[model samples]
Target: MRLLKQLGTVAGVALAGNLAVGAAGGGWVASLVLGIATGLLALLAYRWVVRRTERRRPVEVELAGARAGLGAGLLVGTAMFVGVIGAIALLGGYRVEGWGSLTGAAGLLGVAVASGVTEELLFRGVLFRVIEERAGTWVSLGFTAALFGAMHLVNPHASLWGAIAIAVEAGVMLAAAYAATRSLWLPIGLHIGWNFAQSGIFGTEVSGADTAMGLLHGVTSGPVALSGGAFGPEASVVAVLAGAAAAAVFLRLAHQRGRIVARRSRALATATV
Candidate 1:
């Protein structure tokens, strides 16, 4: 279990390192390479810090849980694709263009895996877990959501609305997704699916990447108010509505399954008392 967790942690660091390097006055490929190579270096450095903090010598994590996480991730992908398409269609004049070739498509897979692996490590593995230990599980989830949204501020086409919507819409939901599966698959899936659909299938900028692929290009005349202007669809109000609805659905499902964090909190309280 510890080894598997370490692997996930390392993969995440590598991806993040690559992104950080790619963005550091470095060109695209350079950033990608550097960000990926060293993301886990931070974890390696901090290993000693956490070694004393872990619970009873790591037990074997369940493969069934991990596999289930993959399935959840797929579900998240499908929902985001559907939601983005529905929202964009309502906005109208959605056109598609700039899609790359097969190589580009394959490159997208790399991008997704890198992002999924890295983001989860940062948010779920580190931030969320820390918050959970300090506060309760639900509090940690909320904090992580806020952090997730804040991170978007740095995305290419991010607007204040985009960031806020991400916080409320995506941040909370993905955290919930992570909490649900214990495995990173669900959250990673949601992240990849949401991003891929936004840029790949829809042809709009995912965040502000200015997609090379033009999936469904329609013409929007207004100040990109309807479409997502320079910042891309993520900034649009449509994304907010769609994202909120998705979050709601996720919460509802969690509630039905008795998985809501509040219940966990109450249980813990009872145990303490």
Candidate 2:
């Protein structure tokens, strides 16, 4: 019942946000403004829903370690994406075409911020956390990651390899971020940094969506395996490997912190009651 309420609230707020943004039209600045605003509103709504449904303390929901999580996530995410993209470039898989306009760059930033915040809140902050309370951490992680990747199947040029890549790279990594820190800020920062660097700076597609003109007008070459073809470098083997390595590290940290919650046994609970 609690989980259902939270999901309903999140969906309602998200739909309203989409409607508001759509009403604003296609201008980049307008989209950016609406996106950011909608993200903020969704966050507030999440807090309210959590409080009302779960009866959690403010500190528990807000997380005292959010600042630290945000900083670490920003550093790690930026470094990881840079390394992955740089490797593709070094392998002759990417090239610089030229430069792009400032407007496009700003618009991309907005998209990144909105996506980072809203998605983290919906997936990690609500769904995963709720499931973890009953089903345990590992189960929640697997389910959420799979769902996240599956959700991208409708994206343009999406492929089997691309969906798998997203599941392992972003889905697992982002969920691991939340597990390690117990805060949405870390995952949100990581998502924003990764997307912004990929499309807004390096001039590449993000899950088959073309970014606005980035700082560099770059393009990928080489084999589909290495270059990631139309779905971009996320489908490349190196990217998946790099993201896996990072996820492993974060999972280790989470384990050390005793953050891996185990599922409660039904028999033990029934006997206790």
Candidate 3:
């Protein structure tokens, strides 16, 4: 019941926000305003719901050190995407056609912020955290990551390989980030940074979704495996490898911090003893 309530509340806000953003039309100002509003509302809803359901302060979304966490995550996430683009460019998979629209980039920024916040709140803050309490970190991570990837399959250009790539790269990477930091801010920032860089900066499609052209008139061409084709670079093998490497690093940090939870059965047995 608690889980349902938490998920329902946050998910409701996210859905409503997306609807509102869509209703606002394609104007950059409207999208940016609505997106930011929705993101803020979702955060508030999460905090409120957690308080009511768990009867405790929601420290994961706590504002303390939020800026630092978000800033660090944004830097790392942006750098990672840039690195992937760089690699693809070296292989002649991507190129700059010209400068793109700043307005489009701004619109994408709004979308990125809203998505980054709401998704991290839903997956990392609610699903992963709740499941980890009983199933253990490993189980929770795998479950959430798979679900995350599966969700993307509904996208316009989605494919089996694309879904798998999303699961392996973004799903696992974001969850591991939460595991390492025990907060949603880092993952949220990373999510925003990655999305914005893809659509807002590099002017590329994101997760098969057609977005406004970003700061640069970037173009991709070559094999589907390398260029990611219509589904974008996120579907590239490079993205998978980079994301997996990052996940590994975060997992290692989590282990060193003793943040990994034991299986419920093992925990119960230890308690009994």
Q: Top model by TM-score, which number? A: 3
Q: Alpha-carbon error at 17 in model 2, in Å?
A: 3.0
Q: Write the residue-wise lDDT of candidate 2 on 1-273 in tens digits.
A: 777877777777777766776677756787678767777777788889888976775353375776777677777777888898899999999988889767777777777877887788778888888778777999999999999888888999998889999999999989987898787888988988888888878889999887677788989989978988889888888899988998998899999999999986888645644
TM-score of 3: 0.97
Residue pairs in collision within model 3:
none
Candidate 1 overall Cα lDDT vs. reference? 0.60
Could you give candidate 1's per-residue lDDT for residues 1-273 as a string of tens digits? 443554455555665666575567554454345533453354342353346456432211234455666566767675766665565666573644434444344444445555665666667766775566546667787778887888889988677777787787678777766565455556766776777666545555666676554344423334455566677766666766776777777666766776555424666756754
Q: Candidate 2 at 117: error in angstroms?
A: 1.1
How much is the lDDT of residue 58 in candidate 1?
20
True lDDT of residue 187, candidate 3: 94
Q: What is the lDDT of residue 21 in candidate 2?
A: 60
Candidate 3 stretches greater than 4 Å from native? 266-273
Error of 2 at 38 (Å): 1.8
Error of 2 at 27 (Å): 1.7
lDDT of 3 by residue, 41-96 (tens): 99999999999988999999889969999998899999999999999999999999
lDDT of each: 0.60, 0.82, 0.92
TM-score per candidate, in order?
Answer: 0.71, 0.93, 0.97
